[model samples]
Target: MKLLRAIGHLIITIFLTALTQVGGLIWLLVLLLASKFKLKKRYLFPMVYLVFNLLLVPPVAKYFGREQLPVFDKDLKPRHYLYPLLFRNYVVPEMKTLLEQSAEHLKYQSIGITYLDANFPFLDGFPLLPHLSHSDGKKIDLSFQYVNSKHQPTDKKPSLSGYGVFALSEQNFTSNSCIENGYWQYDYSKYLTFGTINDLNFDSKNTKLLIQELLKYPSAQKLFIEPHLKQSLGLGHMDKIRFHGCQAVRHDDHIHLQIR
Candidate 1:
């Protein structure tokens, strides 16, 4: 099975190479659409420019002064140093400000949030695996705020695994609950095995507060959630909040916020 999977990946690599092998045209296109602030993949430039990213430079400096905002540097934090490079740039000032404010609010309340992705500094398309629409640096994916089954804030676990879009019915509803080693491991009965983090139950109230907190940002455009979850939140009729529907990953693992 491992050999077959390797063969499959090799085929995919060849296919993408051929598809994007338009050579100069593809490179030029990405350049033309390049963000004025974000340091996109320097595909054509020397790789040495990336050396600074390993230094002690502030998050904002990663953009190399293109004026991009570093929303969150999860990988740069000491405990998370070993994780993949999941941080990226946020270009909208209003969105940036709101995110800072929201993070502060969560911190003040002893709540936590783990960001997963934003625009890849490469293309404005979901060419990257596992995402369908993170292009253009306008969207962000985040682990939902968690609470004990009692709906009270709890310190986020050492690993941000098991957080995802989950049905309220799957939870044990109790006004008093204790956070165990981990909530049920994310159910891979449906989503790809990679999305095993989907079992982390979100505190409905806190998750709703998070969505509301984001909407407070003037640039907030839409919040993609499950239909049932949206209906439960009383946002089913709202214009800016839409359901990602069953056609997509259950999204119980994360929330997608897009800004204008």
Candidate 2:
């Protein structure tokens, strides 16, 4: 009876270990497939469920250890780094340009940018999506930082640059009031452009100048500033240019640029 009980315990341990391996593989597969197919939005639910199970299942957690999953502290601070694809060099120069332009315009400044994912990789938890991640590459997100007169970030307005801004609801982009009522206000200090807005009104003259300058760069091939900005500069669309939707309309918080 003693021997039989020992054997039973061994079998249970082996089975649990195998299950954990399978679960880990599935989670990996989900990430691989989603990236390859660009199916993140489509597979979001299943991926979230898999992440939850990997984090919450007792046997799996014990076998793989909680530390193996994306690390979070008791206060839910992320300890793990996202894979480097999020910060490819192809995208960094454009980001720098936007940031520099924004900084030049602001007297007191704190800025954060991010992509639209739950991971919130950059800041502690502030959500902001980079425009380069969108299909068009023109939509970018930027947020103001509250700073002292000397331009130092204060506790009240923390630095969000590493993390990003988070609140991007579909309604923020699709509502009629978004543009008509200036619900999406443009900050000359932190300028961002979407593909819409072809109306060439003088109100957006400064934004047009920025777009003109951006177009002179070789990297502009990957960007799609607003239509009005392009038209104001008297430039036609290049075949390589593409446009993407701004999932959120309000540029008051973060600038959304569409690539075209």
Candidate 3:
């Protein structure tokens, strides 16, 4: 029982660390306090995690040249509250401004920008797993715009987690070729969506406009999306829009933006 419990704790630690940069440390701290004082993991976990994330991480992150994106805003917002709660929404100040300016440009058209995972606070090289380049606060993912069943634009995403739902069929030739070439992880993001709505349609026009607006910023470096989407959106001429390669998952579901 002791060995099994030790293994369980190890697994949880790794999982938490991978999901949230500081979570494993917090979990270990909870264990330490619990072992010494007979505290409950259930209550202590939330209490300590919230205290560190809410109180300690933000200001400290700012000093490291990172800023947290807002949970709610008129122009830009996170896809889910968990992003900010887990400290997965920190970015360089210029990146934040780029997103805000892009969103504001689309506000008049009634389109809102929904951002996904950015970077972990307080680390220059710590990886934000599943993304090869988000570690430095220079990269972020943005969800694609989608229309509801009624064909009206909505801020709500097809995938509740703002990932995994491919804009077009995942079985397309590019995905198939990549997977067949031993890149099974090419479409692995499909498993990460917490839940999905089946009736959403990709909003091509507004999404294209959003991309255009983002590219207008001098800080904007490049954007990653699928080839099919680039063709579908008539964005083939834009040199800034490029394929992320088979090593990375498909990007039709979202845009990967980077700044210099």
Candidate 4:
């Protein structure tokens, strides 16, 4: 009886040690993965740790009430807009109108506009503009279809035209006011026509015309012309205007228009 008890205790000790080692390795893996990837650190890392502890630590399971994992039922109806990508601030109706008009002009059947920092689960591969980082409540990032010659939606970027309209140049800056507030300040006289460009094709004149039409909506007050064009148009002459907004800092890949 004494020998049997000792053997049982020895087995328990080995099992507990192995369990602790496995748990430690899992935690180490989580740390390594989190550090290596540039994803949401706060939301993802803690969730991983919590799941790990709950599964491997018997004490955690006992304290938290272990239950079978819930299974998703396909028969159940899904909610409409069930998981909308949440934005930092609510978008104004005027902005929504502008986005809708733009989408319509492009003949895109599906389009969406939300605050710049909206959490887009579907757009993980695409490089999101910096203005969409949610720092300012005014900026927004839009997603829409870029149609091809066949009238079908394609994952292509759009193109813009007109020298002063979309091009950032030194001539655009007429005064010091445009420079002082990191180029956040604007004057109507300095305004120019602008359009979107994608895939090195500038034939999308229809998109530019559509933008012009949208600007007529009274809400399209502050149109964010591309910084490259701004520089090309002489807006870069002033140090302040050259680096104003997030676009001035290499996020100029996309346009962030502000409707007043």
Measured against the true structure, the TM-scores of the candidates, in listed sequence, are: 0.57, 0.26, 0.92, 0.34
- Report the number of the highest-lDDT candidate: 3
lDDT winner between 1 and 2, please give it.
Answer: 1
Residue-by-residue lDDT tens digits, candidate 1, 178-204: 123232322332333233432234576
lDDT of 4 by residue, 1-260 (tens): 98996577466544433333233344455546766895554566457645653444433323322211111221111111211211112234445455555545444523222112322211122222322342222335332224566665444444331111222233334333344555552332223214444443222343344334445666665545445544443444432222334324222333445554
Error of 2 at 225 (Å): 4.4
Give residue 247's error in model 3 in angstroms: 0.8
On the 0 to 100 scale, the lDDT of residue 221 in model 2 is: 51
Root-mean-square deviation of candidate 1: 10.8
Pairs in clash, predicted candidate 3: none
- In Å, residue 65's CA in model 1 sits off its true spot by 9.2
**Residue-by-residue lDDT tens digits, candidate 2, 24-142:** 33445555676787877346635654554544442332332111212232111121223111221112234445434433443232222222212111212222233224322233432
- Cα lDDT, all candidates: 0.50, 0.33, 0.90, 0.36
Span of ten consecutive residues with least summed lDDT in model 1: 75-84
